[model samples]
Target: MNTQQRTSTLQHSGVNEAEVSKLFRNTYSLLAMTLTFSALVAFGSMTFNLPHPGIIIMLVGFYGLLFLTTKLRNSPWGLVSTFAFTGFLGYTLGPILNMYLSLPNGGSLVTMALGMTALVFFSLSAYAILTRKDFSFLSGFIMAGFVVLLCAVVASFFIEISGLQMAISAGFVLFSSAVILYQTSSIIHGGEDNYIMATITLFVSIYNLFLSLLHLLGIFGGDD
Candidate 1:
């Protein structure tokens, strides 16, 4: 909905800033549901001891489903595609989680990472919405950082640096947090109207953030 529509709805229906407000409300609602669904799928994957698809296949599945969701964004199929994409990604985490779970402090590490992710996301998002800061300027920088990180990851396959993995994980923590802020800002400013896409963006950010934190914790504080 546009600004005029929001004003009209507010005046007519007594709903405060209906268009933007409704958009924010819907986006968050869908994000919450999708995150829950992703969590359940991840848990199921771990419970069943599902094998990880590895990085190559994992990327293919994620990008492919992501494409599908983008194409189907205007229909009910979009929601289906969103869940499929998230669930697939969640399933891929099973093996990684399993590896961590085998560590002496695995459970605590996972819990700590999760707690940190939650804290960071909520803090950043609330800051954006409450302060109404425009983070749109970070768009180019975030994209560039993402490309650099992706290249670093791909390069890791052939070049084994002593601290490369840790560095990548560290980069991701900041990258994902920036994404959360950027996406939230987009929603607040009405640059994004589609909740499905918004949900995916934030979900991916949180997912990566958790994994990065887990990796960092494992390296620094986990079992020797």
Candidate 2:
């Protein structure tokens, strides 16, 4: 390449790197804030002994807020929608946590689940970021996995089968972990440039992973 061409190529590379870095930083920062806000809301719900909203209300609220977030992703209102989504999920979680906390050794089980979720998320994300491997190949698998899981969840409402529930939990753990890796790789590889959307994806994955771990722990960790 000629000298001028080489310099131009170098400048383009630098700009690309800077943009990626900024996207990564903004995504993580927003994620941290949303997580903290969710936690506080959850604590408040638990402290006040809030009733668990029924499945209908919870689903409506979650999907509605999520839709709003998607529509507003490019605008400042996206932040509000994001928090609304996370906080609603957190509120739902508070009652679930209360149920578990009523069981024997429930406190320890919850703690263990939380620790495992954090460990899995950070480890997978770090591996993806440091290696910058293209996990795009897993995209199809991840989507298929979610579809199967969604079917399982729907069936669970009717079947009342313990084994099926366990399977669903295990599936979530694997798929959610894959999502963390895939989503982080997407961010660094320029597939995902919107920090708001990225935060939503990562936060949902973490939330699902934690719930799955908690369910598995409750089943195996001597709830009775």
Candidate 3:
């Protein structure tokens, strides 16, 4: 209403905008770095023909590093933990990639999956940023979806159900896309103030998206 009040409000709004912008920049910068590092590690693992590390080892290593990252999210140690977690995932991925590469048309399958994952991520992220839509409501859906997906995954291991595995892969593709949008929205809307956490969120979404797409492609496109 009054000039003084209007001016103060404008200044506060500008400050908030600047803070969000900075957070977004920092998050992507860290994400890019981590992705590159992880890729390098994966490449090394593949070149050296590293073992899969087994399911038990993978789970323990992943959860252990993830916990450390969360606990140290506000500190510099968080960056170390984040890289360690991602690198571990990448190392696990190497053996899987090697297996796919052994199949006929495997390279093409891998390429297609990688390309599609990138396309989906960038497109969803752009949509979120351009529209500035609040996707916070998807929070509950994402949580529930992951819980169900996890259960289905565990069941598939014991049941040997092809349909269930396909369903889980499809679900992951959709949910991972949703996560990309939701995380981007959170950064721009000021819901996520920590770049370290934001980077981790986006990176994991990308990882899941890539692997899910790979699984689906391997099923449909790989030669028997």
Candidate 4:
């Protein structure tokens, strides 16, 4: 290529890189903000002894926001949706916090949450950086697993069963952990091209994993 053509090509590539960096930065920054806001809401809810109705509202509202976020993943609205969803998640977490706080070993729950979060992030980050393998292949399996898990969750409401709950929780934890690996791989090499979606996926995976781990811990280490 001629000198001028080379210069033009370089400029275009530079622009692309800059845009990618901006997208990545914006996604993570927003993710952090959302997490913080949600934590605040959860703490507030627990502090005030919020009613079950309010907690339910937070749950429904958060999921509604999640639906919006998914639908608007490619638009500016997606960002707003993410913010709302995270805040809702934080609020929904209040009840769990309240329950755990009431326990003598409540601090263990918080510690478990922090530990799980750290493990997920560190493992996924490592996988993303060290491996060249594409995890998109797991997409279909993850979806199917999620659907099954959702069905089980819904079914649990109608049927009281400990074994089933344990089974489902175990399955969900494994599935979400896989999702973390997949999402990380996608961000690193799958060429997702959209950091907002990436962060959302990663956040969801981590959240679910944490919940699952907590469930397992409660099952095995209750008040001990």
Best by lDDT: 2
Question: All candidates' TM-scores?
Answer: 0.91, 0.97, 0.97, 0.82
lDDT of 4: 0.75
lDDT of every model, 2 decimals = 0.89, 0.94, 0.91, 0.75
What are the per-residue Cα lDDT tens digits for candidate 1 across 31-131?
Answer: 88888888888899999998998778988999999999999999999999998998898888878898899888899999999899999999999999999
Better of 2 and 4 by TM-score: 2
- Tell how far residue 12 is off in model 4, in angstroms: 8.2
- In model 3, the runs with Cα more than 4 Å from the true position are none
Ranking by lDDT: 2, 3, 1, 4
User: Against the correct fold, how does model 4 do in TM-score?
Assistant: 0.82
- RMSD, candidate 4, Å: 3.3
Q: What's the C-alpha lDDT at position 128 in model 3?
A: 96
Name the better of 1 and 3 by TM-score. 3
Clashing pairs in 4: none
Clashes of 4: 0
Model 4 misplaced stretches (Cα beyond 4 Å): 1-20, 53-59
List where candidate 1 sits over 4 angstroms from the true fold.
1-16, 222-224
Least accurate stretch of 10 residues (summed lDDT) in model 1? Answer: 12-21
> What is the C-alpha lDDT profile of model 4 across 44-129, one tens digit per residue?
87888775456457557857777788799889888888877776666667777677677777778768867977777777767765
Off by over 4 Å in 2: none
